[model samples]
Target chain A: MKRNPIGVLLALIAALALLASACGSDDGADSADEVDSGDTAESTSAESSASAGPLRVGIVAPSASNDLAFTQSIVDAVNAVAGDRELDIAVTDGTFIVEDAAAAIRGYAADGVDLVIAHGSQYGGPLQEIAPDFPDTAFAWGTAVDTFGLPNVAAYTVRADQGGYVNGTLAAQLSESGVLGVVGPIEVGDAKLYVDGFVAGAKAQDPNVTVNVNYIESFSDVALASEAATAHIQNGADVLTGTAQMVVGATGVAGPAGALWFGTQSNQTPLGPDFVVASQVYHWEVVLSEMMAEIDAGTFGGEVYTLTLENGGLVIEFNDGAGADSSVIDGAQATIDGIIDGSITTSDG
Target chain B: MWSDFFTTSVIVATLASAVRFATPFLLAALGEAVGQRSGVLNLGVEGVMLCGAFTAYYVRLNPSGWGWAGGMATAILAALAVGLCMGLLYAWMTLVMHAEQGISGIGIFLFGLGATDLLFQKQVGVPLPISGLRPIRIPLLGDIPHVGDILFNHNVLVYLAYVLVPVITLMVNRTTFGLNIRAVGETPEAADTLGVNVNLIRLGAILIGNALAALAGAALVMNTNIFQQNLTAGQGFIAVALVYFGAWRPGGVMAGALLFGLVSSTVLQLKTLGIVSGAASALTAMAPALLTIVVLVIVSRRIGQPSALTRPFDRNA
Candidate 1:
């Protein structure tokens, strides 16, 4: 018998394909069983107020939960909320592709979890499609305002501009070059809003200061982001800021250039300890707690929640290790106060 | 938009940016050109690049405190080693095992993507910054008006790419080894009859191509000074396509890369200058890829790919 290598290769490929499909289905079935057990536990624990079973929260995000950017901000907030309560968290992260995210979202809903968070603006279309199907299971999503007017859906967004304003204020005050660079992911949602506020705040500080904004038009193109930052630095931007996971690339450039960096979504101090001046940390718990309360009170959805500076959902965390002057911190606090008191508007003029 | 983009300062800046952007593409495409010229189409260049980028990032992150230049050299060497290893695996699967080149390449790609992401998550839990190689300006040349800033002022890798383009052109077209590569790629059986070891030459070509592809990845990460999951994006695939776009010639590939780099940098500059409105970003973002397709279609008529580009060679046949 002659050994046919091609035949063996074909068989190996087929076997691997089958194995992949099997593993995918296995994950689906495992989640279904977990949901089934969760439903049973929920019903049993409903009667016991003195000892509540863990409140299961499922999250589907666009990137890793520890990305130190957009997704991590919410994950950190959720963890903080869970610290004082009995909670079980299930996360399906790195779902940048909408189809994968949709499957994960539906899987979590089928699991009969108390709350399912779809944590990306891109997930809105899929959530709108999936939310009505799960009327009993509360669904929350955003960086968007449209709840699709669905009864079982809640929409939450951050006034990221508020924090962006504070960051820009400090960035302007600390800039010796009087030029700031903004490396934005895409010109939409929170990223765009943050850039607009940042530019506005920078101009408000000193009308003559130049603020260069570059939207690399990608959420995960780290290389492009770095190039954009390099271009910015070459063009004389002494201070920089960016939003999304790709900002890691921008910060990488800025840090080495000794340029002050303002970050959004999560604390980016770890990425650039000596260069990261501050971060606009998103504290989603301010809104998440409210959504959880509403769900517990028998309201399935149909409300929009916004994270604002006044509500303490967005906080400007200054990096003390970055050698930021107290004057800059004071100015940042003043800007925050102004925004909260409606004395300063983050809106572009 | 044209008015702003046409300024002297903007033109020089855009050119400089283009050179920086084109380095990785040029390196990878030139590598793929060599491999394709030798009758192999390793679509796994993208995967190989990802592995290289990760290796380089990891090396830079956990440096031997070998100073900046020393650390960069170490990272580049490690990336090349990884690329060579991947090339060997690809060669074995496609050449020895007689696996389908397309599927095997895809398999390599998937393996690289998943393995790199997993290892990165496990070892480096979060993205960290490294002091990447900075641009080194050639004193006299860098001082030469606009030309100096655009062409002479770049990182060492970019300069290497500048030299590699012409050197590879010479190696591929004007050398005896080049003739053997063309002969094996065109007619392996005839080459074998002439006493050339087809398999040995193919293996060598694959290894060299992969090493270059790995260097492309290293250059990308080092240029950026940071690494993230899927950091190469689809640049590797673009690099592969560029070989065809370049007509398998080093010069043509460099030209294609520069075109892409310039277009991309211009779009970014336009977007930054607020000359291109936000509403037009989606269209502008597609500009580089769309232009590549148009160029490829135009060039396809006159230039032909290597005859046996993806055909597996089996001595038994």
Candidate 2:
């Protein structure tokens, strides 16, 4: 009876993995926990500028922290706000299920964190049910303006259309084919706002430019998104934009096709530096900082915060490397200024 | 308006997308056709695809600083390894444990969904892009106009998928193993009487089915040049349908896959040209599923299903 060499090799590798874990220190184990991210793993990192006085925070999101879409927007904002401050951050991401998010939110509250951001609109129902149970713990949820009449809950909403207009203005001028396309997830919610605003802005810039919009009616159907982008490209659309996470698939198609892409929810420059013209980045730090100040002043909630360009909650992140002409950049800034000063209005549906 | 919508460029683009869309379905369904012919109703094809897709993408992400060939080889091997492991587990559950096939299959799907998503978040942490297998144009043939662009300009996986149709057809219809498979599927008792190893044949079929399902995932991830949770996004379940509607015949499965791709791409083209809009567009999204159901219902009645599908084999009984 001959023992297989491959089996022997597998057993040896398993033994080594166990040995490595056994040899690691408590701090190493703690750091490993931070990287062990997901729905179940509450990545609690103990490091802070100050050991005892750092602001304690926890995040419960519906998707991965690095989704480069909705969740990434809040996570990046929180990181920016916590900069140079002794802040302790823990993330329990990929809680797409409502029940899972509710549990994580309660868990963060039970752990007595100073701030717990429940980062999904779907989680709104659960937070409404859970917030009363832990009144002292500050909790926030978004894409909605209602704070559930709860004193301790903070509600944040984004004027994605604000940045959508800026993106639209630039795309209309930049498109060589006089055509633009938008692949929206659904015909409602924040995605609708962005798409509608984009079409409006494109029309405002050039009335003759054909702006096509396709609401595929799904948030995660990547294949359909790809097909929609391809369809738009075939129809002479040189500019493309889509909302929701599934646009990851559309970006892949658009990049190879040399189509200019305008992004929203988060900065998507990293997806394709050469083609992603700009992103309507949500800077939640504007609201989060104000919330922190209110918390320090012994005020917990009772306010609905809207992320507006006027308040610096939304920013049009232009990729200088993508090389838009100075006139286009200047035109974009002028549009932003007009919107901020009430000279321009994003027609809301 | 009609003339604008029926342009040559638009038709060519739609056909090309149909080919790309059909590649994964064709791969998974062909393997599924083989297994179904042997009477194994393994509905865990989608789950196995996720494991394969994730493994292939993760391996290719870093590339181990290897050259193009080395990186591609490594990624493909990793995907195959994951597929083989998933197949063995599924085979054990249905064969050794004699678990209810449909329920166990669903269990596999759910596990793949949760596990792959969790593993991705834990391991990758971010959606980092990878340049997967690139398209290799077929020299002089690729220089031909519309036909060549639509047919000869796809990646190697697309070529492999089309090539395997006849190979699978022959294996299922021409060989001694094929005879044994048909006997077991139709009448296991008679196959046993004839000294056929029913379980071994079934196991071999299951392995081939799952490995091909995995390859379908790899093809998808490679073509997309990216990975996401549930990246296959119901394509696996659709692949399983392709097998059933295709009547356990490789050629039929290929036709079913192509039909689905064509319907989907054509509707997209219509929507883009503004021929479909408002309520019509919403309804158009359901066109592919409706067509698939219609075809499956009509085709299945005409060709019929396997005699012993989803039936567990026990020689003593």
Best by lDDT: 1
Off by over 4 Å in 2: A1-57, A84-88, A106-116, A132-134, B1-4, B67-69, B135-146, B294-304
The alpha-carbon deviation from the true structure for residue B279 of candidate 2, after best TM-score superposition, in angstroms, is: 4.1
RMSD of each: 4.0, 5.9
Write model 2 residue lDDT over B116-224, tens digit each, in one string.
7767766786676777777788998888898887888889999999999999888878999988888888887789889999888988888888889889989888887
* Candidate 2 chain B: 10-residue stretch with minimal lDDT: B64-73
lDDT of 1 at B58: 90
TM-score list, all predictions: 0.93, 0.86
Candidate 2, residue B48: Cα displacement in angstroms equals: 1.3
Candidate DockQ scores, in order: 0.46, 0.27
Candidate 1 per-residue lDDT, tens place, A242-320, comes to 9999899888889888899999999999998888989999999999888888887899789999988999999888888
- Relative to the true structure, candidate 1 reaches a TM of 0.93
Two-chain DockQ for model 2: 0.27
